[model samples]
Structures are given as structure tokens and as C-alpha cells.
Target: MTRLSSPAHLRQVRTGNMHAVLVAMLDGPASRAELAQRTGLTKATVASLVEPLLGQRILAEGAVVNAGRGRPSRPLRFAATGPVAIGAEINVRHLGVTVQRLDASTEFERRIEVDNCRATAADIVTRLADLIRTAIAACGRDPLGIGLAVPGIVQDGAVVHTPNVPSLNGIHLGDQLAAELGRPGTTVAVDNEANLAALAHVWPHRLAGDDFVYVSGDVGIGAGIVIGGAMFRGRSGFAGELGHVIIERTGHPCPCGSRGCVEQYAGLDAIFQAAGKRDLAALLLALDHGDPRALAAVETASAALGAALAALINICDIETVVLGGSYAALFDHIAPGVHTELDTGVLAATRRPIHLTTSAFGRAAVTRGAAALITRRHCLEPNLLLPPGRRQ
Candidate 1:
């Protein structure tokens, strides 16, 4: 062991070593020797670091593996039951909660439809807190932390602006949710839903590669930009406001006080109005029946969405785009129009391929991404798994 005179320095080294071990295990189960080789630490050090994690129920020993020549070793894996993370989302049409283990396996999940647009911020927070509590109870464990997804601009745990859900503007949602949950010092991270959704694609695995954009469609439209396998929140943390980008100077009015924004044409509300459908289910049904109105509505929305995406791609120089939320549901109906616009509007389309796809999670992507935020933090800073008094 390297000796350090300062206690803080020793703690920092230990935390770093522990983080290395945890991150190595993220690939799968590994023995002490494997961890040592992967993290470039001595086997003795790996054993010492992993002991506390096993004692704390963060890691468990799996079946013994034969090394061919040496003694069989027991592989260690993330425990299936301990130190779960909570993910919650507050959207215009619904509230969702997801509890996931360190391995990214969902343990408990729930989603409920509600007219959040008609509710006050406080009321919505109360409802979201209830869902979180229920999830915690269902999981039967205290969450290591909570991650919240909201459809708006977030800066330093506060919502700076949310045009569709106006009540949340200027609210420090993370702090309020932590207080409401009666866990004052617990970590409650708040971020734009689209950003989180984009993260969900990257953390466990890079579903969209290192450079890509995730565009979310709902009652509001937004984009989550990823570069170098990390989220690209601009200088002010309000970078991916794809909905506000102007498409038609004199087009339909938008809630963000803009005219001809892509959201005005491509958002679910606009599609419903154009298709004469009451809700997504109805619109999906209309599309299934090959109704001309529904097809036309989707075609128009897709063209506008593609145009906005073209501008985003041109500026960011990203080659991949993943359609999420309602867009994922309507991919078959709307993809051709988006593809046509991309081919025409994207300057590099002829030289480099532009890949467009749908999110596997659909609308649940936001909540899943929120959960990943917590787990990723824990993996990077394993000291967070310790009791407050012991974490230095």
C-alpha cells in the first residue's frame, strides 16, 4: 500500500481504486485476478478493495471459474438487490417512475397518464414524489440517488424555462423533490428529459454511437445531443432546444411564443389536430386504417422534423439521429418523409451516410436515462456507496 500522510489523499486514492474495480465489473462478472489485470492493480489490492464492497452488498461472488492452470476463482458481479437507483419523469401528458439495479436491470416501473398541463408545479411534484415513494417501497431498498427528467431547460438543478409546462419555470426541482422525499442530503439530479434520454442510449451501451442526436417527440419537441459519448450541454446548459428552431417564419403559432417552429407542425398536439384524432392511440389507429388525413398529418410533420434535423446535423456535424417518444411509434408512417428531407437538406448526405433510427424504449427512454445518471455516478465515484459519515 502506498503511504500518504494526509487522510484526504489516502481517501482519494482508495476511492479511485474502488471506482476502477467497479467500472471493470460493468462489463460482466470478473475474478480478483481479472479485475487486477483490467485495472492494473495488484491482486492483493483488488481483493482488499472488493472486500468492503462485498460486505456492503454492492457486489456478490458468482460461480467459480476455472483458470485452466491456477486455483479456481469466484467471479464477482453487481448484487441483484442492493443500492438501486430511482428514475422519474414529469412530462406534459404523464408521470413515470423506474427503479433499476446497478446492472441496469429494471426492478420496478410504472407510468400513469395525467393532464400535467392543468396542474401546478407543486401539485405535480407531490404526485411525482408519491410515485417515487411507491417505487422505493416496491424495490424494498433505499435508492443510492434519484434522477429526474423534465421537458425543459435545466441549469444547476433548476428548471430555467419550460414553455409547454409553464408552471415549472424557474423552479429548483431537484431540491424540492429531495425535500419532499424527506431525504435532505440525498442526491437528486435534474436535467432536460431529452438529454437524459440521449444518455440512456450511451451509458449501458452506445446504441447511437459517440456522435449522434436523439430527438424526442411528445406534446413538445426537443433534441438531446451527444458528442464523444457524452452529452453536449452548451455554455449555458440549454443547447439542445430543437423545438424552438424556426422552420416557417409565418407558420403555426407555438407555445414558446414562436411562429413556424418545428414543434408547431410535428408535436403530437399538432398531429392530432390535423388528423382529427383525440389521442396517440386514436392517431395510431387512424394510421393503421390508412386514413388519408392521418397520413397527410404525419407526412407534413415528418418533413418539418427532417428539416429541423438537417439544420442540427449541419451545425453539429453528427451523423446519427435516433427518433424517440411518439416519433418512435410513428416511424413507419413518417420515416420516408424525414428521409426525403434529409437527403435534400443535408449537405453531407451524398458524401457521408446519415443514419436515422427509432429508440427501443419509445416514451420510456427519458426515465431509463434518468436512472442511468445515478448508476453512472456511483460507478465513477464508488465512495457514494458508503454511509454519509464514512464518505470523506
Candidate 2:
């Protein structure tokens, strides 16, 4: 006689089936029959799985489609409006928020420039909370969760070390933001800004592959590594510290108390210092005018950046490198130098060419990436749509 399955086992199986159904629709709409075929589940089981999703407004019936011989069927698509995810960022120069639906459609977004380096952690949290509150009001619904991007090492929802924004050091930013918003129950995820920016490239049909390293260029440099379609946070969640990769044994000083780090040579500040530009806008204008000093500065930084990246690629075996943050703006000038360095530095370059590209989102990548983390979780675990007590 066959033994009955335990409740826990049954719940696990059901959750997997639901996830399959949702993932099958990522390309577009699908009927129950199509979903059954794609997910390897019976039509009846597919129907049972979709009912709650439809009822919860997570999925909606689209216009009927006819495949000539078979009966007409209405495809199921993600609802135009449903649970939304909020993404926020705390950068040295800006604070930002973005609200997005499960379909990846942005509902609300705002960014304000500020001298966050000088602001206290409490003041920054207050301003960011107000922005989140405004986004919630504009969306007219409570977000499913919030993802925060900060420029530093993050551990257990707290910012353990942020060299650029020291005020946030050792702060449980996620909990503080949630409490500031008076929604202590809301889930807030905090992570490295570069890591989140890298996620943004992967989810919602942005990046082409599962393995790559995203290097963020700014006042501080960081990298985000993606392998097999998921982030590789390494043990203790402090893996992608690209900025601190020592290129010189005794070069320039770093805020992290390290000397000759890559950031001292390739970070935006270094480039600006070399070019004598006050800011990114001025530097871009100079580059546009074919300014010799600006071009030279970019070349020097690119060489240093390439050396650091070559070492990372050698170890991680990542073939694609996407330059984000301020680097995106300087891509045209920097790519050649970086390519030259990679060709000579990477051992694997003899077998395969490394692909280097610029991020489409530019400075907006971190914020958008923060939002993607929430949407990704919602997609993989649709049970989150159910009431707290009812979720398996």
C-alpha cells in the first residue's frame, strides 16, 4: 500500500509547482494547458494552482487565443497592478527610491542629490523614509518589501562598514528604516550597492548570461559577482570588495586603512583629481571637447581598473565585465585601455575573449537593482501573495 505524503512534503511539492507555473509565464502569457506542458504537471493540477493566483490578482486572464484546431483559450498573464516592491539607495551623493510592480513596470521613482557623507545616519534615514513614504502614497498600496542599496559591506541587514558614509557604519539600516516608516513588520533587505546593481542586470530580461562581474565606479569602487544566475555572496557575505584589491604594494592610501588599493587609482575621485575636474558633468564636457588631460586621466584609471578586473576574472572565471555607475559614462574612452590590459593579463584570454560593456542604467542601476531583489523573491515564491497565516 502507498503511504500518504506528509503535510510538509506536500507543501514543498505544491510550492515548487506554483513556482514552475509562474516561471513558465515569464516569457509571456500561457494557458493552463500550455503551463501544464511547460511545468510537467497535469492540466488539472495547473488549474488548481492558478485559481488562487487569479483570485489574488497575481495573474489575470488575457484575451482569448485560438490555435486553429484546438478550442480557444485565454492565456494567463501577470496582473498590471498588484503587489509592488520598493528599492532605495544611500549613496555618497544621492538618495533614491523606486517602486515597481511584479511585471517590472516602474510606478514611482525619485532621486535627490545630497551630501550624505556629512549627514548623520539618523538624518539620512529620515529623508530616505520620507521618500519611501511618498512612493507608497503615490502607489496607493503598501509595498511587499523594501530593498536598500548602500555603498559598503552589509551583513545581517545592517551596514557593518561603509568607508564613504561612515555615519551608517554599524547601523542596522534595514530595521531603522522600517521603524522610521512605522512599518516594523515590513521586510527590508540591505546589500552592497554594486551587488544590487548587478542583480538588476540579471532579472527582468536585462543581462544575457548568468556569469559576469559588475564593477561600480564612483567615489568608491565595488564589484558584484553573478554566477549561475544567482549572486555569489561568498562566506560571511563580504566577497565583492573590488575597490580594495591591492594593485600596488605601497601606492596610495585608502579609507579602509589599506594602501595601494585599486580605488585610489581608478575610482571617480582619482580620475577627477588627475583631470582637474570638479565633477562628473564637467569631466564629461571635457571629454566631449577632446581635452587631453581628461583623456589621459581616463586611460590611467582604465589601466588600473583592467589590472584589478583581470585578477578577479582569473580567479572567478567570469568572462563578462559590465562597467556601471560613473564608469558607464566613460566607457567609450576607457574600453580600449581596459581591453588591452585584459588581453595581456587574463590567462584565459588566449582561449576566449572577454566581453566588456557598459550598464544601460548608469547611476540608476543600484536603485533599480534594489527593487529587483524583491520582485525576484516574489516571482520564485508566489506563496508570498497569500495571507501570512495561509502561506505555507
Per-model lDDT: 0.91, 0.90
Error of 1 at 294 (Å): 0.3
How do the residues 273-345 of candidate 1 rate in per-residue lDDT, one tens digit apiece? 9999999999999999999999999999999999999999888889999999889999988889999999999
- Work out the TM-score per prediction: 0.95, 0.95
Model 2, 173-266: lDDT tens digits are 9989999999999999999999999999888765738899999999899999999888899998788999999999889999999899989989
Off by over 4 Å in 2: 1-4, 204-206, 389-392
Find the 10 residues in a row with the least total lDDT in model 2: 1-10
Predicted structure 1, TM vs. truth: 0.95
Q: Any idea how many clashes model 2 has?
A: 0
